[model samples]
Target chain A: MAAPAILITAFVVIGGMATALAQSLGLFPLVGPPSLTVAAYAAQASDLPVGIGLSLAIAAASTVVACLVGFTAALVIVQGRWCGKLVAALGTLTVPVPHIVGAASVSLLLADSGLLARLFNAGGSWPELVGGPWWIGVVAEYGWKESAFVALVVTGTLATRAVSYDETAALLGAGRLSRLRHVLLPLSLPTLTVSATIIFVYSLGSYEVAWLLGRAYPEPLPVMALRLFNAATLTARPEAAAVAIVTTLLSFGAVAAALAYLRRSTLWR
Target chain B: MIPAVRVEGLSKSFPGTGAPVLDDVNLTVEARSCTALLGPSGAGKSTLLRAISGLERPDAGRVLVGGQDMAGVGPEHRGMAMVQQRPLLFPHLNVLDNVAFAGTVRGVAKRAARADAAGFLELVQLAGFGPRPVAALSGGQAQRVAIARALAARPAVLLLDEPFSALDPELRSVMHDLLAQLRRSVNPTVLMVTHDRSEAAAVAEKIALFSGGRMLQHDSVERMYSRPVSLEASRLMGGANEIPGTVRNGCHHSALGALRLPGDTTWPPGPGILLVRQESIEVGPGNGPGLHATVSGLRVLGPRRLVSVDAAGVLLRAEIPWGRALAAGDTVTLSIPTSALAVVDDPDTAHTFPGAEKRPQITVQGLATLASIDN
Candidate 1:
């Protein structure tokens, strides 16, 4: 029943990757004769290390922040209180907003001379959050948006069966903290792992959020690739393809590592 | 000694529901004794058990455990353990670790708790089954592990919410035997909620009957079956026949004919219901000197046959041993001793009694033999 969707996804991803790989090898260049060479990859040697490290750091930070916040949100929501209902509503509302819109909203809220700076009356003293050295604004956008996704998925799995087990544990003399440590954490681990992997891969490959909120010196892979692809010099196209291919390989590597870890986890079953 | 658990004037009502889920309930379970909360679905039996365990807070009531008021105590501090119908074993833990959960939560070392848990596993007859993941256990084994885990806590009170109802019949019987063994060894004060009358009668010393959130009667298991307080209570306890009639002097005049009531029956002369258990009625050939009855229907129920007889215009059911051969339409005589007769106030013309009705214990040979046969 799902064969068609899976086939279409596979075809698009594989075909696009093949085209990028061919271009990175200096074949089918936009303004030059078709020729095979490693010149584009060699040209990117200077900037590739910085871009890769920045991208990995951003993705890792975002995934960690999202998982922690999302797990807490899910625990609160499953508690079935009025505040839990409010958190659930907030998560539901946040999931549908595009990452770009979230990035814009975050920049408006955290930037120097932005809403927060005016509200706190710290115009001159406000930290450089937006386009900052730490990439705070960029990571915040992805973390805030992706945490909602993680919360909803994890809440779905916990709401069904966790309550009974929790009650049973409590009846067996488990206190609140003990129950959270033994019951909730172990129960939510598998879902948290899966959502974390998804967030990491997504933040690693997405461009617009980082481009709008990041500095220009040590740009993330997606932002660097987009800038190189749009540069006026035609030779930069293959280098852009090379960066894009590297990003794809990193995402694939993250997914493969997650799957391997899940396969070995006793609770994942 | 003070009762192990005491509930007084307990009541609860959920919002948007017309009737209360539990209404002014009171009960007492003695230390080291087992009591079965017997009722139908939605009878608030489980609600009462949860309220006692501190899992549920009653709108207006006081739960006292071992003479200490448990008003603000949480479920963890109540020293109670509950085994639900589904087991709810921690899937992430192995069988040994699951059983050791209570001790570990109390800050005991893992190796020491597991060592103590090994003994509990042996009590439930699953000694070597430890070290296996909970997923590897069958339904019966899982439930046994749940019971073992609860027992490992050494709780002051154990609450069971239809723990065996989810298992197959044969497995349920095996679990009943395991409970009997546990009772002999641990002697934990127990309150179990179940809709299965037989299960209640088999495991509990006292039976508390509930209906529509009200406790009808609380008495010994023998009395609950042989002398129920009301027609509803009798029916709930698996009473097969209710002969509606009037009581005058000491005799109940009904369609089955006038029968002398037991000497200690407190029922005043008024409308009454004569409750006769099916097994209490003895059937023989027509030559016997008893009420004449024609066997109208015969049903094969396992090793026993349910014999439906028409005695004059009144019908009665009698369970006979399958070894005796008697088909439908056979002329038979049913002899019921006057001592076996019990009369309760008829709801139409009198107020039904809600308190425990204690009658003199009368052991009929057939009732004893039937119980033994079942065992």
Candidate 2:
């Protein structure tokens, strides 16, 4: 029974990748005889580097911020206090909101003429956060959505055996800061790494959030790929496929590195 | 010297429970001495330990260390260490680092802390186990490491919660000997909680008996065994053959017949329970002058035989040498010496005499054999 599902998933995923590879190598021509060439990859050499750099910067920044806030939230939730329950409930509520919707909401909150600027009466004086040179709104959307995911996963890791270990540490003369440094942080590392890698890969490949809140020039890789795929000129399709393949490779690299680190962590046992 | 640890009027209760788990508990541990908190499960012995360690805050009480009140003190600042039933060594650290943790938290240099931890490991007979992962250790070895880790802190008070209860019988004996030897050199004020009376007797100078969240008695181990405060306390310390009777004119009258009381008997004439150790009962042929009983059971236990007898509908237990060769249905005369009798006023056991209602039979044959093996 499982074989059918596995075969179908493998066929769709590998078939899609094969189609994209063929297109990127100049085959599957829409208006001419199919042929093989590296011109599609070579065409975007100048623009591809900028897109990749921007994509990596946004993903890395978003992942770091998400992990810090999410890990703190997890600690609070596992403490089993009233305010901790409230924070946990808010995180649960935030997790289900679509990224595109979160991007729209963030734009309404942080745009120069948006609600925050109106409430503060600092219109025209508010920092350029949405569609600005920095892509603050795009990073904020990804961070807000993915932080909840990280918090939920980390809370699970702590719920199992953290209490007994914490008590033992306390009895062994560890203060609050010492317990966190020695016990909580090391115990939570493997889970935090896995969650951060997921956030990085998701932010790198997601197009809708960046298109909704990003600038037209110097776009993130996903936004650049979408623009090229939708261009009136038919030849830009192969360049879009090349960008998508590069994004996939980067995500794979990040996941592999995280797994290697997890294998070496003492707490992984 | 001031008592190393003192607790006064400690009381705690959980939500939805009408009774407190620890009720007005007061205890003191002399400096450089070991006291065992002996009780059955759910008797709040472990709770008292946690309260003294500052892991649980009592609703009402005060804990003092070295004659100083610890009102606002935290566990880390109280200069106390605890060993739990499970080793609970941190999985993220090796044995050496886990042992050195308290030193690191106190801001000791890493090299010095490790050196001190190594010395402690040697003390616990795990000299070369410093660099091994905690996961690789057996149950006994892990528990030894836990003891070493707790000692590395050099605490003024050491609290252990049934630390050896998880080991095999042989390992448990080894740990008891190791602990006794360590006490001579490290000599921290130790309060160990265990349900096993023999373990307490082996390792503790004083024993505090607890039941139903109330402290029954606290005295030296020898006194606690010889003169238990009540019949329940006597049974807890392995006292057998409790005979309910009445005291009258320097003699006790019961189903076993009137017997001369000890000259030091001070009880005014009334109903009481007489306690006799199983080893104190002497058996002879049916021709002797004593209460006549028929042997109902004979169990050959290594060097001795446990003989069960029925005397005029009263059941009694006696231990004799294996050479007696008595069999079931043999008539014998049992004599309990007057000096060996300890009368107790236990209201709970007043109507629990062998012939009154139904005697609560205790199956301690296996326990006796285990105790003998330990010796």
Largest DockQ belongs to which candidate? 2
Candidate 2 Cα misplacement greater than 4 A, ranges: A1-5, B1-3, B248-251, B258-269, B284-290, B298-306, B319-323, B337-339, B348-375
Clashes of each: 0, 0
Compose the digit string of candidate 1's lDDT tens values, residues A128-212.
8999899999989988999999999999989998889899999989999999999988988888889999999999999999999
Docking quality band of candidate 2, CAPRI definitions: high
Query: What TM-score does candidate 2 reach?
Result: 0.91
Model 1 regions more than 4 Å off: A33-36, B1-3, B349-375
Worst 10 residues of 2 chain A by lDDT: A22-31
TM-score of each: 0.93, 0.91
Assess candidate 1 and give its lDDT: 0.88
lDDT of 2 by residue, A92-159 (tens): 99999988789889999999989999999995789989999988998888888888898899999998
Candidate 2 lDDT, B314-351, residue by residue in tens: 67888898665688999999888888777777667645
Q: Candidate 1's residue-wise lDDT over B186-225, tens digit each?
A: 8889999999999998899999999999999999999998
